[model samples]
Target: MGVKTYDAVIAGGGLIGGAIAWELARAGLRVAIYDRQEPGHEASWASAGIISPAPEHPGMIPLVPLGKASAGLYPRFIAQIEERSGQRTGYRAQGTLQALFAREAREELSTLVALHHGLGLACDPLHVEEAREMEPALSEELQAAALRPNEACVDNRLLTRAVLEAARRSGVEIFAGTGVEAVWQENGRCAGVITSAGKTAAGNTVIAAGCYSAGIGGAGSYAPVRPARGQMLALRSPALQIERVLWSERIYFVPREDGRVAAGATVEYAGFEKKLTPAGILSLLEAAMELAPAARDAEIVETWCGLRPDSPDHLPILGPTDVEGLLMATGHFRSGILLAPVTAQLVREWIVDQRVSLDVERLSPLRFRDAPNPAS
Candidate 1:
């Protein structure tokens, strides 16, 4: 009506931003999303879309509730996206198996199994022979496998596409290939963003630029996000059918619907570097081959890299900053894809109505204000 200052203007049109825009638009708010490239071309595309619950490491038990909430929202979330995009998100409800090759490794796997079971999440313990029989691709290695039935995966690329399409369907404006060079502030509030195209728009703005958040002119000081490059390879195996996701000591193998098994990923701390290293590729291939000998037989087809935007604390930075009407939703680290639903819901609630149903104070940007690194 009044030129629509936009109930929200979001940066980084990947899974998190697109999801938030879709929810906000559905709730009848004017929203706009700015992206350096088209949505889902970054880490969201490279992501395996694993929806595993936070692994129980004693002190991190609180994450279970948050993860379960997001997972609970998945059924409805997937349905909404499919209905909007007219395409499946590859939402494979098949469970994930954390296979252990030795009794020594079982100690840790057993703890995870106990934790998931104690939390009342569906999971099963399978004998080595049984697991191999279920997926003949699995090596006849020793020990056991813990299957987390409640956790599953989605094709992040399709899910991301669905979110973007849903947002457009709901009237949210999308500016792809229009990079927001900086956040412009007026007085004490968010004015909007200035893009490389020399165009300016004013409204409430959000910083969700993933690893590139640190490069944003005015917002960089508040964004201490560093790029951790994860290199992965895809293998096409017509003779193999890896029905479920498999996890091991070094890496994980996720099978796709198109007769390809996705093997990944090398976690490297190369700053702003997205190049793949020979060592990284070899390591992934070795780990994957050990778990599924069929991987060696499969033709290696694709190799690429994506940066997992990490914070000093490894937790996401959410909530508004000291600047009124300007929000921070970037530092999600490795769990970005898995945590998209909750991030979107929480951020949308914060922008539209000024509060979230959950108390995300611990994850607030203000929590890091006084820390050694304010960007943390």
Candidate 2:
């Protein structure tokens, strides 16, 4: 039998890859996704699933526009996927509460509020009592809090599943457990992928392989994505209640629909190794206990880690590459789940219409070509 050809081939099966495949398939193009493990078993499955455009750190503020765009598309995107897959993605728009723990932290609230306000983003400052009243689970030590009503979250694992199912329904052939060993190129363009199962041909090939993207042969030169390890843990707190996502400088807690309070994460420069260290767990538990005293009593349900794909500047390396027919949708860092919908839309527009609606020149894969090596 001759090798099956697809209109587009996706390397990687995480949320980014899966969402892209779903979008392409929905656009009436045959697609194929190659993954070493079952799709979304890595970072997507381990994510706390918080979708806050409000920066977790000062460095992330510049990327808020991208986050906001993606967040806006979530409602319609989730609706479409759920209807097609017959699965609930557990997407919630309840907003997020940024708790101010120290007196000094309270001083920074006005500046943070102003920053968001300057961008015309929705952010409401709350008094300590007001914050406590909104979420009684918060510790009494909280001096102030801010509510970003536009921010939301979802069960990333469930969303990934829905995307995969929707892609299958849209005629995308998903090759789970099939690792793409090399980029099958022809005439100086990306033709397809060579997987363990067999070679699959396509007009366009997408490297959405997350942390492992740089390791793909023939793509290492331009895709300089590296793994930034994040350690996370979940606790089963049936009685401990929190209405929305809660955050402080030290840690953040996300309440699941099923009474599991997901708390994360310790960002480390450790490459690829996803081992849950004792230090990581201790730091998370300490933060959780400090924020909500009742969290100490909550049963420890699971401890795991995820390798977030990070670029040098922490922005995603999206859009087309110098290699013809080769596109990129990786280096999303922690925003993979939050960016899925917009990314899918971006890829669709780029491939079908030959033009991108969103300005992604900053995220172009060629941006890293002149960067100096860290070892030097």
Candidate 3:
């Protein structure tokens, strides 16, 4: 029999690839995903699931619009995923509270509120008394706090699995253990992938392999992604009863429905090493207990790490590249969970409609070509 071809073949079966495959398959396109291991077991599973669109730093300003758009799309996205996958994503829309503990916390909070207002973002300064009332587990040292009422969180592990299941139900063929070694290029155009099993031809190809994207032979230039290792631990405290997601200058706590508060994450540039160190866990615990003193009594339930895909400028690399039909949707770094819906929508739009709804020119992979490599 002649080789069977698909409409699209994607590398990396994480949130980005799975979402794109589900979207495309729902649009009636033949799609396949090749992952190095079981889907949704990578960064997607290890994420803290904070879905805030607020720029964490000034450098993240460009991502604000996209992040907000995706955050807005989340309710419907979760509803659809739940309906299709028959599983709840543990989506919590209770918003987030950022507490400050420094001596000059009131001044710092004023500056933070001003920054949010200047950026046209929603941020309401909360009296320390009111903040502590809302979350009684908060430390008595909490000098000030602000509420981002629109920020939300989800159980990313469940969401990833639901998306993967939905993709499977939509008839997207998934090759879990099959790693795509390179993009199959022919006559100056994109084709499909060179997988460990062999060649799989398709009309289009996408590299969404997270930190491992650069390892795929023909993808390094367009997706020069490196791994940023983040170590996280989970604490279960039945008596703590922390409701909203809590954020301090050092660490953040995400409370789940199952009585486990997930605290993370030290951003270390350790180059693909997923090892958890004593210092990393200790720092996380110190920050967690500092933010909520009650956490000191909580039981350490779990500890893990994930490698976020970091680009040269710490911005996501998206959209079409020099190759005709090869597209990129990697380098999301910390925002992969937040940007998955928008990224999938943009990728599907590009492949199926030849254009994206959003002005993603700044996120294009071509922008990297003219820029000096940070490592150099």
The clash count for each model shown is: 0, 0, 0
Candidate 1 per-residue C-alpha lDDT over 21-55 given as tens digits, one digit per residue, 9 for 90 to 100? 88888888788888998877998888878887655
What TM-score would you give candidate 1 relative to the actual structure? 0.93
| Candidate number with greatest lDDT | 3
Candidate 3 local lDDT, 26-118, one digit each (tens): 999999999999988889999999999888888998999999899999999999889988988989998899999999998999999898887
From the highest lDDT down, the ranking of the candidates is: 3, 2, 1
Clashing pairs in 1: none
Considering TM-score, which of the candidate structures 1 and 2 is the better prediction for this target?
2
lDDT of 3: 0.91
In candidate 2, what are the lDDT values of residues 1-376, reduced to their tens digit? 7887989999999999999999999889989999988888988888889887766677877778888899999999999999999999888899999998787876789988998898778989998888998899899888889998988889888988988998888888888899888788888888888889888899889999998888887666567888888898888775568889999889999888887888999889887788999999999999999899889789998888999988888888888887788898998998988999999999999899999887778888888877743322
Clashing pairs in 3: none
Identify the candidate with maximal TM-score: 3
Query: Where does candidate 3 stray beyond 4 Å?
Result: 370-376
Q: Can you give the lDDT of residue 146 in candidate 1?
A: 77
The local distance difference test score of each candidate is: 0.80, 0.87, 0.91
